[model samples]
Target: MTSTERSDTDRQGLSYYPWWLDNLADDATLEGAAMNGTARGAEAVRTIVAKARELYEFQDFSYADVFGDNGFLEIYDSSIQGEPLKVVVTVTRNAAGQAQDLAVLHRPRNSLLLFSRLMHEKCAGTPLAAHFLSDDSKA
Candidate 1:
């Protein structure tokens, strides 16, 4: 897709082709509330993001806009395992327009706990598992 092209929007007006998906830099990093520390590299970021998207039962974007010279921000309401979740995602891009940093913030302690647990379950047995809560930890 070209810079001017936008992907399809769902009923909730969420873009199917969010800018970050296609623009993540090779050494991109991901960090946020649901993560233990940080996930590095494009492949790791992609894996985590794809799994998170799958766990969301519904999403309605309330706001999305450019943040700064090379940043984009998105805020949305969503549901996972029937629990309501609110998220703010910020993406920072490199000079080439490739996303270099991605930050995700989830709200509502209860919802964040549930989301983190679910993510841990899905990432089990993978290298990415290290960046999530262990089974022994409280969800």
Candidate 2:
């Protein structure tokens, strides 16, 4: 699809987290034609996808409530393995569903490399995260 068509859907059908993932995916590919900034982007996306899937996996699934009120999830990027990481990602959901809020449980300083951290704040209908805009650090 063209850029205009892509933007049209951006307003509907998908939420911010999934949309960001999509963009990162494009950055990883040759279609966009960019020669840089995508090598690690693609790896980060795949790691994130795997992390999200683990939530529902029958085996190796935590099932235990990791984050009581803040959405939390982790992505282990093998793309830039051994390199330190320093970026922060927050995935929040307004709809009532299984995958609702995504929060940043912990942050790494000097190094952005964090394969995983405590993630998942509220289930779709639980609404216990305090509108997502809440400051978990203070709470």
Candidate 3:
């Protein structure tokens, strides 16, 4: 669910913490901890989410009717397990040729960052998953 779904309101102040999460008083971003209670590795999920947001924003998927072209995956999610989700985004050309397709995969519950970048690279056939992930144009 979106972060908003988990927030609450109280007499003293606004509570953004979701009852499902641990250490409610602690911020997840501190010490580089992840929402799933994992250490540095948890950052991986944040990485994915960041990627998804990039895609959504770049494509102008902010409105409710827009329904961003991005998709999500939830691997080993606290709410589920062993889910490998994938999504593809398409960019049609105005050059009279068929529209091009780009895959954007989200590993189960990942934030859709690293893997999506890899998938986009693979779709573009730019040495994805092999090299040049950080620098797509270099390879």
Candidate 4:
């Protein structure tokens, strides 16, 4: 698809946080503790959403339309690291019904180098910077 073109997913108005997610309230929390130098609420939301978009290469998927819940757990076949792989992503919603957490399981575990690199690059020199080079990357 062309970069300027919108996919059917886009036509459906998928976003980092869909309207249904507002049920979580403004103080809703994501899974991880706040990274150093970042605020807890909105900053956490932006950072986590940005990271997911980067990892998924901006593909849009709907939790409501696909799973009829806050989130879904699925395995994706990806070649982002230059070979076939199965990556498991578990998305969960907080009690308030906001999709607030994401966990990814790399099949080989060590296959996350590219993902880490991209995150590090994107987060560099900002309060959003992550210690992804260390074990804290999992946050």
lDDT scores of the candidates, listed in order: 0.83, 0.29, 0.27, 0.47
Q: What TM-scores do the predictions have? A: 0.88, 0.21, 0.21, 0.50
Give the TM-score comparing model 3 with the true structure, all chains together.
Answer: 0.21
- Candidate 3 structure quality by residue, lDDT tens digits, 77-123: 11112223333322222132222222232334353334334434433
Q: Candidate 1 has what TM-score?
A: 0.88
Q: Give the deviation of candidate 1 from the true structure as CA RMSD.
A: 4.3
Sorted by lDDT (best first), the order is 1, 4, 2, 3
Cα error, residue 80 of model 3, in Å, equals 13
Q: Which candidate should be chosen as best, given lDDT against the real structure?
A: 1
Give the worst 10-residue stretch by lDDT in candidate 3: 57-66
Candidate 3 local Cα displacement, residue 42, angstroms: 34
Model 2, stretches more than 4 Å misplaced? 1-80, 83-97, 113-139
Residues 108-127, candidate 1: write the lDDT tens digits: 98888788888889999998
Model 3 off-target regions past 4 Å? Answer: 1-81, 84-88, 100-126, 130-139
lDDT (Cα, 0-100) at 115 in candidate 4: 54
